[model samples]
Target: MSRTRRTLIWGALAIVAVVPIAAAAYSPFLAWRSPVYIVAGFAGIIGMVLLLVQPLLAGGYLPGLSAYHSHYIHRWVGAALVTAIIGHVAGLWVTSPPDMVDALLFVSPTPFSAWGVIAMWALFAAAFLALLRRRLHLRFRTWRLGHTTLTSVTVLGSVVHAMLIEGTMENMTKTALCVLVLSASIKTLADLRVWVIRTRRFD
Candidate 1:
């Protein structure tokens, strides 16, 4: 097969694998609970997976792709991730009013709530900074430093939140998903560090 055809095939296969897992995680309806929550939880899981892939795609780790293609995919996937997280939070708010208040106050009875909140804020900050990166006259080095710091916090908080939550991601499948997400995040961070070091040495 041609390289482009092979890439498309693999990407399709990945999407296929992801769909059923998402469906299973977020069933259409639960006997005693609202479907919105389920949908949001599943969206959250999918968002994390997309976030994991964004760095890889942007780094051209995906087979038969150019850097520009990777960059485009990364940007769109990031937007999707943000949308999914918003849906997840909104659903949780609708389903559990008191819990939402506690989460906002960072005093939720659930250990994971605080982490989730923190991650949300970090994500916001990172997004905002990305938008302002050029306007802020940020040196590439400084911008990278700040971005890495915030991204690390976001990933850590997200992992903690996922692990502590007993809702959608409660079993071995979720556990594996979490590990994959963490590994991906770690790999990206390591790569970034290496890049920075090499650039500094060359300069």
Candidate 2:
């Protein structure tokens, strides 16, 4: 399929997967689980997976794409993932006022609440550091190290939060998603190590 077609297909699938959970007033399965929370959870999980897949997809895990095209696609995909994450968070807040307040205050009394808060903060830190990387006039190595550290913490915290939550994702799906998150994280670390080694060797 063409790149545009592929993008549309994936984008539509994402919407379809998320719409049911988002549109409902309450969860179909769990009476206590709100639709907004379920949708947000789905969005976050899908966003995480897409983020993991972006590099491979852009790098021609299938064939027939130029490097420029791949890079362009990667940029668009990254933006979409960020949009999805924002939607997830916003929907959750709109649906659950009490939970949102507790989560924001870091006093939810839920195992995942603290982790989610940490992840949210780490995300902001990473974004801010990226934006100011050049303005801060830090050395390339130092900036890179800080960026990677913050990103790792964010992903780790998010995974922990997702695992601790027992609402939308249940049993096998939850376990599989957790494993996918962990695997993606480990793969990213390995890729970074390879890049560092190659850079040092060239230097």
TM-scores, each model vs. reference: 0.83, 0.68
- Which residue runs of candidate 1 sit more than 4 Å off their true CA positions? 1-23, 26-29, 194-203
Task: Give model 2's TM-score versus the native structure.
Answer: 0.68
- In candidate 2, which residue pairs clash? none
Best by TM-score: 1
What would the per-residue lDDT of candidate 2 be over residues 91-184, giving only the tens digit for each residue?
A: 8888887897898898898979889878777766866776677799876677667866776777788778877876655545555555655666
Q: Give candidates' CA RMSD values in order.
A: 3.8, 5.7
* Candidate 1 backbone collisions, by pair: none
